[model samples]
Structures are given as C-alpha cells and as structure tokens.
Target: MRLDKFLKVSRLIKRRTLAKEVADQGRITINGTVAKASSILKEGDELAIQFGTKVVTVKVESLKETAKKEEANNLYSVVKEERVTAE
Candidate 1:
C-alpha cells in the first residue's frame, strides 16, 4: 500500500490528502529515511511521522485497502511517541 493511503486507512492522519502533504513535505519517514506520498508500505516497516513538535514511531503490522474504525489499530503498532521540547 502507498504510505499516504496506509496512514489514512490506518486512521493515523485522518485524511489522505493531509497525509500526502505531510509526506511530500518530508514529515514522514520510512525505516529512518524520508518518504514520499507514493512510498510503498509493507508489513514490519517502521514509520516515523512528525506532527508539529511531536514525533510518532510505529511499525506496520498489516496492510488493507479498507478497514473499519474498530480494526484500524491493527494496522500498526506504536513504538514510540514523544514531543520535542524547545530548548
């Protein structure tokens, strides 16, 4: 699945367009490298997303074209989440 679509389908970003924008702006990383909106997502890949000062890291658990809200969390596992502190 595409990174942007995976983010939206997994309910992480809430919208596909927002996810695409974020990816395009280099706020999204796959396996520690910046990823574009069309980046391919695969199971077990690590994804790090920057949202303002907060960073969220997760591992892709599954990929699906469509999933119900209740099953969204099954798509990825949160590995780390931290807010950057201004120094």
Candidate 2:
C-alpha cells in the first residue's frame, strides 16, 4: 500500500491529497527513515507522522483498499504519540 493511500484508507488523515502533501513536506517517516507519499507500506512497518507539534507513531497491522470508518483503526496500531515542545 502507498503511504498516502494507507493514511487515508486507515483514517489517519482525512484525505489522500493532504497525506501526500504532508509526506512531500517530509512530515512523515517509515521505520525511522523519511518517506515519500508513494512509499510502500507492509505489515509490521512503523510510521511516524509529524502533525503540528505532535508526532504520532503507528505500526501497520493490515491493509485494505477501502474500509468503513469503524474498520479504520484495525488497519494500524498506534505505538505512541508525543508532543514536541518548541525550544
């Protein structure tokens, strides 16, 4: 699955375009390395998304082309979420 697609399908981001924009701006990483919007995702891969001042980390659990709102959370497991304080 593509990073942007997964983010949208999983409901992490509201839309795929926004996810791509975020990835293009280098606001996302896969397994500790910065990833692009087209980055490939697989089961067990970890994703760290920088949203404003917070960094949300999640592990890919499942991939679905389309999922209902209630099934979105099943696509990934949130490992951690931290707020980065500006210095």
Please name the candidate that would achieve the greatest lDDT relative to the true structure: 2
Q: Judged by TM-score, which candidate is best?
A: 2
For model 1, how does the per-residue alpha-carbon lDDT over 1-87 read when each residue is reduced to its tens digit? 999999999999999999999999998899989999999998999999999999999999999999999999999999999998766
* TM-score of every candidate relative to the true structure: 0.96, 0.97
State how far residue 25 of model 2 sits from its true place (Å). 0.7
Superposing every Cα of model 1 onto the true structure, what RMSD results? Answer: 0.9
Question: How many clashing residue pairs are found in candidate 2?
Answer: 0
**Against the correct fold, how does model 1 do in TM-score?**
0.96
Each model's lDDT comes to: 0.96, 0.96
Cα lDDT over the full model 1: 0.96
